[model samples]
Target: MTLELSEPADVDLEAVRRVARAGEPVRLAPAALAAIGRRRAEFVAFVEAHAGDHLYGITTKHDVAARTVLDDAARAEFGRLLPPTPPSPSTLGPALPERVTRAAVLARLTDILHGTAAIRAETAARLTTLLDGPLPAVPEGGNGDPGDVVALGRLLRPAFQGTLEVGEGMALINGSPMASGVLADAVLSGRDRIARLEQVLALAAVAACLPDMHVDAQLGVLWGDPHQERVLARYRELLAGGTWPRRAYQAPVSFRSAPRVLGGVLRTLAHAQDAATTTLRAASNNPVFVGPDLRPPLGAVLSNGGYHNPLVSPTLGALAHAWADLAQLVTAQLNRLTDPPDGIAAHETEPRTSLFPMTASGWAEQARAAAAPGLVGLGRSGQTDTSTPDVLAWRRATDAGAALDALLGLLAVTATHLVTRRGDTPPPALAGLRDAVLECYPLDTPPLDVAEALDAVLAHLAAR
Candidate 1:
C-alpha cells in the first residue's frame, strides 16, 4: 500500500493498527503518500525561500543555541554535525532502533499531515520510502527517549547527510507519534490478552459444567439491554434443554452478570481506541506549521507542549495496568472452571466403605468428607469442623475471579469486533453483550492477533 499523505484526522485506529500489525514493509495509501510528498515539498520550498535568512536551524543556530543564527553556507555543516551537547539523564532506558523507528517515521508522516513540523515533502517521502523499504537494524532495550532520539537522528542523518541545517535534528527528535504508537501497540497487545481470556472463559465453562450448562439468558441481556424482551428471550434459551435449575440463578451465579461484566470491558477499549486515533492525527511538534494561510506570528512559532504527549503517557500506563488486570481475571476463571467441586453446588452420590465404598450412606459420608476443606495450611482447623464457613470470603473470591474473566471478555469482544469490520461485516455496538455461547463464538476464522480478536467480536455482532 503506497501512502499518499493527508491530515491525520482522516486516519483511524484501524489504520494505525494495520501498520503496527503489519510491522514491516507497510504501504501507505497512494493518497496519503502523495500528501506526504506535497508536505515535504512545502518544507523544501520554505528552506529555499529562507536560505539567506538567519533563521535558526535552517541556516545557523540549533539545539540550545538555536537563538544564535548563522547566515553562511558553511553553517549548513551544522546539519551534518552530531549533537555536541551532553545527553540528559533518563530512566526510560535506551531508544528504539530502526524497527521501532520505522513506526516513528510512519507516525511522523501522520503528524506532517496534521500540517505541523518541518519535514520537507520529498524528505518526508524519502523517510516513508525508507519505512516502506529496507530499514536499518535498531538495538532493542535501553532508554526509549535517547534511543528514539539517536534512532531518528541516524535515520534522518543518512538522508540529510552533510547538508543538515540547525533545527533539523530537533525536528526529528521532538514529536509524539513514536510514543503514541507505543501506547497504541500497548492497547492492541492488552486487547489481545483480553481476547485470549474470553476464549479461556468459554473453555472453563465447558469444563466446570458437570452436565452442559446454558448461559443464554446471561449473554442475551448483555447483547441488547434496552430490549427487555430480548433479554428474556435469552433467559428462555438458558432454560431450554431441560438441563437447568428450576429457578434462574445468577450463573456460576456470579456469571449471571456476564453481560454487564463484558460490556464495561468493551466500553473501555472503545475509549482507548478513540484516544489512540486522536493522537494519530494530532499536530504534535514544538515549532509547528500554521500553513501559508495563517497569520505571521503563529505560522512559524515554536510553542511548548504543542507536540506534547499527555495522552500517550497516561494511556500507556493505563494499558499496562489493564494487562495485569486481564491476566488476573482469566487465571481466576480458569481456576473455577477446573474446580467443579468448588464452583458447582451438587454432585452425584457415592458410598464409602472400609474395604469397598458403595452404598448411599457411605457415599454421603465420603461426599461430606470430600466437601470439607481438605486444603492444608488453610487455617480452617482453628474452628470446629461444625464451625460456619466464611461464605462471604468465598463469594468475594468468586467475584474477584469473575472480574478477571470479564477483563478478558472485554478483549475478546474488541478483537471479534475489529476483525468482523475488517472482513466487511457491520459494526457492532461496543456497549452490549452477546446472547449466548454460540453468539460469542461467531468468527468463521480463528483470530490470529489482537486485531483479529476484535474482528471476531464484530463478526459475532454483525451475524446477530
Candidate 2:
C-alpha cells in the first residue's frame, strides 16, 4: 500500500515500519506540497531582501569560516564549490539495505514538507523521485565528527546533481536524516520484537504451567500500573481454560513477576515510540525557518541545533536495557524449566546435557552486554560538538536488534524443551509456536543449531 504524507503528524511508527520493513511506496499529499511552496516562497523573499546579510552556508563559508561574507556572485560560486568532497572512506561497508535507504529519504522528505527546511516544493518532488528509484549508498566508519555529514553529503550528492538549487543541497545533506531513518526503522523493528516477546513469554508461562494467580483481576487491581494491568489481561487471555497442573504454590520470581517485568518492557516501547515519532516529524536541520504568520510578513531563517537528537539515544538505550531484563527473565525461567524442583527430571537426557542451558546462558550474557547504555557522558570530546546522531542511533539500534535475536533464541529453545517433556501436548494458545519449534528440532534429537532455530522462529513470527 502507498502511504500518503499530508503533514509531519502523518509520519507515525507504523508508516515507518511499512516503508522500511515492507518496502511500501509513499507520496506527498497536495496540502503538504502547498505548505512547502508557501514556506519556500517566504524564505526566498526573505533571503533576497537581506541579500547582503551573512547567513551560514547560504551567504557565507561554513564552520570556522562562517565569519566571512559572500556577495550574490560569490554566493552562487560558493554553491557550486560546496558539494561534499569524497572522503578517505569512500563507501560504507556492506551498504545499508535498500529498505533503510528508502526510509531515510522518506524521512527527509517529511522534514522538508514540514516547511522548516525552506526547501522548494520542487525539491521535495525531486526527492520523492529519488526515493521512488534506487538510492545512493552511504558509507560507514567516519571519524564520528562531521565526517558522517561529509560521508552522507557525498553519498546523496549524486542523486541531486543538476537538479538542486542554491542552499537546497546543504539542507538535504545536513542534520540527522540518516539517524532519523535508521532509528525509525529500529523502533519499528523493536516494536515487532516486543510483540513477539510477549507471545513467547505467554508460551513459556503455559509450558512451565505457571499459575494464573498473578493475572487474577484482584491482583491486577493491587498492581495498579496500566501496563501491568494490560499484561495481566493478556496472560489471562493466553492461559484461560488450560488444564495444565501448577508445579508449585509459586513459580520462581521470573515466572511470578513475569507480568511486571513484561509491563516494564511495554512502558519502554511506548517511550521509544514517542521519541521516534517526534524525531520522524521534526525539522532537524540547521538554519531552520521560523517566523510568525500573524506577526511577520516574511519568516526569518534561524540557526538551530535540532540535528543532535538527545531523545533517540537514551530512548533506544532504555529499550535495550528493557530487552536485556527480559532476557534475564527468560534465562531464569528456562533454568527453572530444565533443572530440579519444578522440571520433569524423567526427561533429562544425554547429548543435550548442557546444550539448552549453555545456549540460554550465552545468549543472556550477550544481550546483557549489548544492553549497556550507549551515548552516555555528553562531556566526552567530539560528542557535544561534532558527534553524529546517525552513528549513535544506528549503533543503539544494532545493539537492540542483537539483544532481541538472542532473547528470541533462548525462548524458542526453552519452549521446545518444555513441549518435549510434556508428552508433546502444548497448551492451545502455544500450539502454533510449539509446532514451529518442533518443525525445527524433532523429539529425542540433539538440539538443532541455536541460530538456525532462532531464524525459523523469527520467520514464523513475522508471517503471523
Candidate 3:
C-alpha cells in the first residue's frame, strides 16, 4: 500500500479506524514518503537559489512588517534571531504547540506533494518519522493565551533546527496543529469505534429478543435506504441461521422492532465513517501553492480556513453521542436478559427446538441483579447532561467512552449465556463472532460478577 501524492490514493479507512478505535500506530506508505522526499529537495533548492530575495516567511522576519530584502548569505543569519521569550506562562500550555507541530509536519508533507514548501528531502523524511513516532509528552500547565502559538513555536524550534529556513519557520508555526492532531486522532478513532458499537446495538436488539417488526422492519427500512443496505446486509449475514430470532418470538414486545433500532445505529456509524475518511484525506494548511511551483513565479500564495479543524471537533462529538445511544441500547438488552420475568427462551415449536431446553431461571436474571447500578448510572449521567450542546457535545463524549467499556462487559455476559444455551447447534457466524470478541477484547471483569450486576439491573427494569 504505497500512496502516491501525484495521483491521489484511497484514504486508508482501515488505518484510520484502527488508530481511532484501537489507539494504534499510524504509518505512511513508501510512495508517500518518497514523494515527500522529492518535494523537500526541490523546496530547499528554491530557497538556496533565491536566498537573498524578500519573501513572506523566508528572507524577511516573520510577525513583523516586511522591510528590506536580505541576500542569501544574510538570510541564513537573519533566521537565527529567535523571537523574545514571553514574560508570562502560556495559557494553553504545551499541548497546543505539540498539536501545531504535528499539523505543520502534515501540512509540509502535503505541500511537498504540491511541489511547494521548499524544504529538504531529509526534512520531509524527518517529518514523516515524527508523524509515525511516539508523540512526545507535552506539559499541560501554562498561562499565556488559549491559542498557545508561542509555546508550539518554542517546542518546534529545536526539532526544526537544521530543516527550517526563513519563511519555513513561520509556515511551520503559523497554523493550527494542536487542534489538527487532536482532530485527526479523534475522527480516526471515532470511525473505528462507531462501526463496532453500531453493530453491537444491532446485536443487543437480537439479544433482547425484541419484536420482529422492531428488529427486521428497521433493517428493511435500512435496506430500502440508499446507503445503509450494505451495513444492513452485514447484520443479516451475522444473524442468519442463528437461534436468537426463534428465541425472540417467546419474549415480550421488548424484542420487536429490534432491527430498525439497530439499523438507525448502523446509519449513524456510516456517517461518522464518511466524515472521518474525508478529514483524514484533507489538506489542512495555509498559503497553499497555486500549482507545480513551490515559490510561485508570480502573485502571492492562497491562504484560507482549509486547515482550521472546526468540523473535526463537532464530528468527534457527534460520533461520541452515537456511541452513547448504542450504549443505552445495550443496557436495555442487558436488562431484558437478566430479568427472569422477561422470560428468555426459544419456543418449542420454532425451527431450532433442539437447541435448548426452555429455562426461565437461568443466569441472566441473577447476573443483572449485581451489574445494574453502573449501567444505570452511566445512562442517567449521559441523559442528565444532554440539556444543552455543552452537555451533548463535550460531557456526553466523556460519558460515552465510559459507557462503551461497561457495555462491552454486559455484551460478554450475554454472549456467554447464548453460547451456553446453544450447545453444538449454534450458528457458525454467531459462534465465531462471540469467540472473536472474547479473544480480541476479553471481558475486563469476571463474567459471573458482571452477570450478577446485570441481574440487579434486570430487577430494576422489572420493578419499573
Candidate 4:
C-alpha cells in the first residue's frame, strides 16, 4: 500500500512505520508538489541572481569553517563542493537497522515537503522511490560528519550525481531528522512494551495479593489525577476476574505507586511522540527562504538555526527514566513475592515459594544508571565541534527497553509461583500470562532453575 504524503501534518510515526517497517510506498500529493515547487522557484531565483559567496551552506563552508567562503566557480559546479560520504562500514562494524534508515529517509522527505529548501520535485520523488528498494547501509558508529551531511549525501547522491544542484545537498543533510526518526521508533516500541508490561504488573498485583481498592476509582478522584484514575481503572479490569486476599500491611510502594509510574510512561512517551511529530513537520534548513506571498513580498533569505532539535534529548531521556523507574518497581514486586525474608509476603503465601528472584538479575540497577539525562549541545566559543546527543539518547532508551526482557521473565515466573502455592487460579487478565510462563517452566520447575527457564519464558511472552 502507498502512504500518501501531502501536508507536513501528514507525516507521523504511524505513516513512517508503515513505509519504514511494513515496506509500504509513499506518494507526494499534488498540494505538496505545488508548495515544494513554489518555494523552490524563489530559492533558485535568489541563488542565480546573487553572485556573492553568501549562499549559506551552498556557497559557504560548514561548522567552524563558516567564516570561509567559496567563489562563484565552486558554487556553479553542481554539488562538487559537497563532501563525499564515507564508505559503508557494515562488514567492519554494525549498521543501522533497516527500519531506522527507512524512517530517516521519510523524515528527510517530510522536511523537504515543508518547502523550506529549494530541492526539486525530482529529489523528493527519488527519495520516495528509495524506500521501495534496498536502502543504503548507515553504519552504527556513524562518522559524525557535521549535520550527518555525509550520511544524507550518501543516501541522496545516488539519486543523481551530475545535476545534484546547489542547496539540495545541504538541505538533505541539515536538521534533526536522524534524531526524530530514531525517537519515532522509540516511541512506538516503548508504547507497546509499556502496554504489555502493565499487563504483567496486573499479574504481579494478583500474585502478591494486592487489595483491589489500591487501584479503585476513588483513589484517582482523591489525587485529582486523571492519569492515575485511568491507570488504576485498567488495573481494576485486569484484576476483576480474580480475588485479592486482604493483607495486614499495604502493597509495596511499587504497587501503591504503579499508577503514578505507569502514568509517567504514558505522559513522557506522548511528549516524546509530540516532539518527534513537531520535528517531522518542521523545516530545519539553515538560511531558510521566505516566499513573496503574505506580508507583501515576505521574500527574504533568512539565516537561522533550524538544524539542531533540542527536545529530542530531554523527552527521550525522560522516557528512559520511566523505564528505569518501572524496572525498579517490578524488581521490588518480584523480590517481595519470592523472598522469604519479607515476613508480610510469607504470611499470605506458602514459604516454599521463597526465593530471591531479584538476585537472579541486576538489570534494574543497570537501567537506573543509564537513566541519567544527556546534554543538548549548545555550541560554545571554545568547543572543538558542536554535537547532537540523540545518538546517546537512542542508545540509553534502547538499553532501557532491553533490560526489561529478563526482568519481566523473572517476575512472570515468580508470579506464577505465588499463584500455584496459594492454590489460586490467575485472573482472566493474568491467565494467558500465567499459562505462558508455566508452560515454559511447569509447576515442578525448581526455583533454582529460574536462570535456565528465563529464556523460554521471555520467548513465550514475546511471541504473544
Tens digit per residue, CA lDDT, model 1, 1-464: 53344557644555555554665444445676566556555655665666665554456554446556665555656655534433433343343434345556667766666656655445555556676565554333322331234444545555656544444555555555665555555455445544444443433332333222344455445566433333334333332332211233233543444334444455555566777777767776755655554644223534445444556544443443333343444444433432335321112111100111112123233222322221111222321122111211122222333333344444344233222323322112222343233264443324334334444554543333
Error in Å for residue 329 of model 4: 1.1
Tens-place lDDT digits, model 2, residues 284-358: 877677644832877777767866677766776777788778778888877777775556334756445456677
lDDT of 3 by residue, 1-464 (tens): 32223422333354433433343433455676676556555545555665565554565654333466766676776554433334334343434333323443443344444444434455555655665554444444431222224444555555675555555555555444443344454444444454454345445545555343433436556458634455455556655565654453444433343344545655665665565555545554444434335345532345454434445446546556555555554555555655443323331123122111122222233223322221111212421221112112322344454455455455544544544444423345556545544454333435344345545433322222
Total clashes in model 4, counting residue pairs 3 or more apart in sequence or in different chains: 0
Per-residue lDDT of model 4, residues 242-335, tens digit only: 6546566788787788787887777777788888888777776765666667323436656676766777778778888988878888788777
lDDT of 4: 0.72
Better of 2 and 4 by TM-score: 2
Per-candidate total of colliding backbone pairs:
64, 2, 56, 0
Best by TM-score: 2
Report, for every candidate in turn, its global Cα lDDT versus the true structure: 0.44, 0.69, 0.45, 0.72
- Model 4 CA deviation exceeding 4 Å by range: 78-81, 84-93, 142-146, 150-163, 294-298, 341-360, 378-385, 446-453
